[model samples]
Target: MRAILFVLLLLPALCFGQAAKQKDNPITIGTKQTFHSAILKENRTLWVYVPKSFTAGSKLRYPVMYLLDGEAFFTSMVGTVDYLSALGKMPEMIIVGIESTDRVRDLTPTHSPFWASGEPANDLKTSGGGPNFMAFLEKEVMPYIETRYQTETYRMLVGHSLGGLTALHALVNQPALFTSYVAIDPSVWWDNQLILKQAQKALPQKGSAGKSLFFATANTMNKGMDTVRVVQDNTQGNHNVRNSLLFRETLRKSKNLAWAWKFYPEDNHGSVPFPAQYDALRYFFNKYALDKDLNDSTITVDYIKNHYRAVSAMLQYPVLPAQGTVNSLGYISLGKKQYAKAYQFFKMNLENYPTVGNLHDSMGDYYVKIGDKKKAMEAFRKALSLEEVAETRKKLKELEAGR
Candidate 1:
């Protein structure tokens, strides 16, 4: 009897411990994925960051940001993007961080014996593989991501240092690969300003009307030099800044590309990437703001639709307001006794998402408010067919009994 009582008492504790463990499980930020790349002829590891709103079953698709030097910047980029999106500065996106196997070999666009210092550097012997790396991204990596993930048409590329050089190369050579490019302090002096020279010739020839680019440079000049002195001195230490300025000027002359450049005097090469990334996101998504008071009588369904329509055109993708947002607007209008406005919102939801059960239920509620008993019955029946909920079934039964 004593042994049985002891065992019985311990069973509840064990069950409670299991339940607590399940409830307290840690949430993961992202996942690591690997695949064999035929172009690179090696296994490539990718760090994928999905937004908090992402769900495996949802039909929603997100824009993608491909960040170079994934191992170094994935966590920070994820945090930055999430924070900015939560504040409505930009849309939430998926981040794909591409880890580097050989930084010099994959990031350099030309095979040259000279380094950024304009001196012979034998370490560049394995360089000039940027074309191959881009091929890997276009042929292998992008296909894998598109097929495996729910992605939108808009894509952005981000890089720093040598990786920034790679991003510029992609923007110049493979302009169609991404919609926007962010190059933070790119090593434009690589091979004695080869990319700068290339950009002058390529950007105008290709026509960059629809694409966007944000490039920033740090205070890489020598201790005594300012912007003017750096350009005039043309010293080896000042080559990076000079090359970046030249590239910026070349881009400015092109009327086709929507571009922005910034010079951060307080940040060095190491410290510039973080703030540069933040500013780049802000610049790219400058048009994606919805400044409206939801409670105001002036707010209408047309206003919301027009705002998102403009955003959709900017992103070149169909962007819609969230379902919950429309639903909330409907309820707010209903509470204010604005029957026409409430009907417009509820009708817009039905048009956008015909299969959503809650939307149909809300539509039924709106019909009931307008004293349309027949339409109310139809909406409630549609909602019950989509989802067999007890409340909807009860509402349908009550309507049928009245008939």
Candidate 2:
């Protein structure tokens, strides 16, 4: 009888463990979606990475990063953003990686008979469809993503190789589309430096006051030749390096836009994107870091508000401290018995995220700690109204019964 009872007792725990594992197994990092494009006249598969903080009903909206060469770069970019945002080096963002059907066709701005090496570029016969591709993004992709996802006004565009060429093309021809541009080892030598020439003329005329760009090139010289030697030698193989420098100089002379460039001697074209993407993101968000000495005594609601207000001005959109940040700070204060500071942080979060049930629940906990039973009940009631979770409902019932 004791053996049977032991087995019966073990069965419930085993079943519960299995159920918990089953529930957790289906959780994913991100999701894949398909959208039919009227402009491209085909369906495109998109890889999307929503931040961990994103919830279905939350009022929070995130900036979106549209990555080119999605099949190659999507996972790396998602990992990079996820890691950095967790460190607060940058804000968590939504990543949308658009898969390509015909890369050369979609990435090249002008059709050319000769390659960057001045050889007959027969492989680019169907090139010069960049305008149409941009149209597809502007008309179809952006709208579709905005409709389906919670996105803010700030958007970033990232590309590599042929995709880098397209990113530069967009910057020159359509500067208003993205807030920042990152082009890694871009093939700017296409069509005898056609895009570079266009950039020299168009970029100045367009007035890139609020725009930011970071472009980098890898060492493409012969084994013996350095950057200076390759430029002086001007070999066909040097066309890419030479044209990229010219493009950089042209933009520098324009002097209207915020731009930065880096050359990696140790990294070649294929290996450059790994570090380049990380650096580009860091460079664009360089001002996002908070003062390191900040502590519970120094933190104030106005200081937090003002910091984000400045961030809003820089990003051209209203942004606030993440709900998680506020909640964590609130709890940290409460744990230290800093009731006033804890209440301030919690109240600020409630003001920012009025609809979030957890914020109300946290505020109730804060009130209870400060021995304010009436306010605690009010907060608990608010939480129960927003969500009928058992713990919150039980807390409310206990409070009511005690009265």
Candidate 3:
């Protein structure tokens, strides 16, 4: 009777485990390909998904995202890419899921034991081959894809769990490997967090100018106990977010480079990738918006004006530049001696950042030079409306006198 009761008591757990491991619904995509990597000398397969409208016209090459754990993730990622691209939330890109037939041998950096507890086992002997895998992608896989498809130079890499660890390993050890990297719930606990330590030592303290990386983690249950605490520790544990934060802060103080890091506390090991992947894609494309017009001399003030005008028309509303991009563009315009363009940017800046007294004050001077008394009065009035210090008050008084 006790034995039967024990089996009954464990029924739910058994059912849940089976459900969790069941093969996910097969995702259908627009295209798929399989090939061997000359660099790693392994047979690799990649799935490609182009949106319905993609083939209608234009030889448009797209940014590519190379994903790990292809069999399980290919369809979901294709769905994400399709939905996000259609909504204009992310740039359209080719989905390249590298299906690994030998996961254990290809994903790890070193030949090491699976557990930190020092358990003996030949059952898991096929381990540790990350460097070669990276080489396979770089030398064999990338070349094949680029040659066969409409591809842009902009590339992104993504991995989950062990794959995420492998992605991180590639980034720190091979900084030039990809333009952007997204690692979700990376097994930072792997190999005693050896890769984490390597990241600490390898992350450049300055000049992240063209490089980007996004790493995230999810909660995992430990021994049937809600492993929230352990996962939380991992999220905050190695200071992964904080380390990246400190790196960003240090870079800021030194004016080193551009990088962003974020934390996702809601997802556990299996569920975190969904959000991280979307955000990472947006982050990368926005950071590196390619110039369709490559001719430097053709990129004139008139060009910028036309672009913004088109933006306004397309949105059917005044498209104000965000304060930061506008501020940078304003200064660049002024330095380039494109007065009219500079004025447009400064005016937009004033609209977005009305409380900024300095912008108004600067606009006042520009208006005065242009002999627009009415506009100058408006600018001076806006400036004086703010908390006026002695210096600004004096400037306001001077403008009021029409001098």
Q: What's the lDDT for all of these models?
A: 0.88, 0.86, 0.66
* Residue-by-residue lDDT tens digits, candidate 1, 1-403: 9999999999999999999988997767789999999899999999999888776577878999999999999988999999998877789999999999998888888888676665787777888898898999889988888998899999999999999998898888888999999999999878777788889888877788779999999998889888877776858787778888888889977658899999999999999999999999999999786777667778788898998999899899999876777888899999989999999999999898888888999999898888898999899989988888898888878887984
- How many Å off is the CA of 5 in candidate 2? 35
lDDT of candidate 2 vs native? 0.86
- Which is better, 2 or 3, measured by TM-score? 2
RMSD of candidate 2 to the truth, in angstroms, is 5.8
Please tell me which predicted candidate would have the highest lDDT against the true structure: 1
lDDT (tens digit, per residue) of candidate 3 on 3-31? 99999999999998899779567656756
> Model 2: runs farther than 4 Å from truth?
1-27, 293-296, 335-337, 388-403
Candidate 1, lDDT over the whole model? 0.88
Best by TM-score: 2
Listed in order, each prediction's TM-score against the native is 0.85, 0.86, 0.57
